[model samples]
Target: MLEQKHMALLEEAERRAIAPTDNIRACFELLALTGAIDRDCAVRLARHRLSEGKFVLLFLLHDKPDGLSPHELAERAGVTRATITGLLDGLERDGFIARRGGLEDRRKIAVALTEVGRQMARELFSEHTQWVASLFEGFTADERKTLHELLQRIWRNLDAGKQQTGQTADARA
Candidate 1:
C-alpha cells in the first residue's frame, strides 16, 4: 500500500483549490499510478533500444509463427497502419523481422520474426515479465482480482461516458 510521491502534493493542492470527494480522489490516484507505471516502463524499455509499442509488436509476432499482415499487426497493436510500417522498418533494419509475400495471397505481405528476433523476444519478455511482477509482488491473489475488476469497471464507465457523448471510436484516436 505504498503511496506515490505526488500523493501528498495532490492532496494539498486539492484541499486548497478544487477539492475532490473521496471517490474522485481515488480515481485520481488510479490515474496517477497508471501514468507512473507507463512512464517508468518507457524509460526501462529505452535501455533495450525499444519503445513500448515496438516491444508489443515483437511479442505479438513471437506467438504467431505464421506471421501477420501489416494490417493485422496494426489492429493487434492498436496503432495505425502507418505506425506499424515504421515499426516494421526499424525491426527489419535491426534484423528482427522479415517481410515476405503470402504464399496463398501473393498480393499480401506478412511480417515474421528472424531467429535473432525470436531470441530477443524471449529474453526481453522474460525479464520484463519479472519486472512487472516485482511491481505487484506484495499483492495477494484475491486483492489482485479485486483490483482488476475495479479497473475494468472504471474502464467501462469511461467508455460508456464517451458513447453517451456521441464520441465515435475514431474520436478516441
Candidate 2:
C-alpha cells in the first residue's frame, strides 16, 4: 500500500503469518533494509578487494593512532576472537595491518595499521563515505539527523535491555 519494497515485504511477511505486531513488523523492515544496504556495500567493497569486516577494522584503526588489541578489535567489531584473528591475518597478509609487541608485555600483541594500511584506509573511507552519501541523497539534513537519532535511541534501548539482563552491553557494531 505504501508503494515501497520494505513495506511490501512486511505486508507479505504478515500474510505469511510472521507475527503481525507493529514492533515485529518494524524489526523485519529494518532487517530487510539493513541487509540490502550491507549486501550492496559489501559487493562494492569486494570490488576494491576488501571485505565488510576488514573495511570496518580499517576505519576503526583510522580513528585510533595508538591502535587496539585483538581483544579490543573483537569487542568493537562485535565479532568473535577467531573471526577478528582471521580478518587481521588477511589484512596483514595484504600489508594493510601489522601486529607488534604490546607495551605491557612482549607476549601481548598490539594490532595496528601499517603506513600502507593508513593510505588505503583513507582512500577506502573516502569512497565509502561518498557511496553511503549517495544512498541518502534524497534525505534532507534534518531527516538524516532524525534517522540517526532514532537509530541511536534504538541501540541505546537494546543496550539497556542487555544490561538489565546482566549481559555486557558493548553496543557498537
lDDT of 1 by residue, 1-173 (tens): 22665567566767877655566567767777788899899998888778888899999999888799999999989999999999999889988899999868989999999998899899999999999999989999999999899876676568675676776678756
Q: Which candidate number has the best TM-score?
A: 1
lDDT tens digits, residues 70-115, model 2?
Answer: 9999999999999999999999998988899888788988888999
In model 1, how large is the Cα lDDT of residue 170?
Answer: 84
| TM-score on alpha carbons, each prediction | 0.74, 0.66
Please state the error at residue 116 of candidate 1 in Å: 1.7
**Residue 98 lDDT in model 1?**
94
CA lDDT of 52 in candidate 1? 88
After the best TM-score superposition of candidate 2, give how far the Cα of residue 18 lies from its true spot, in angstroms: 9.6
Candidate 2 yields a Cα-based lDDT of 0.84
User: Clash totals for all models, in order?
Assistant: 0, 0
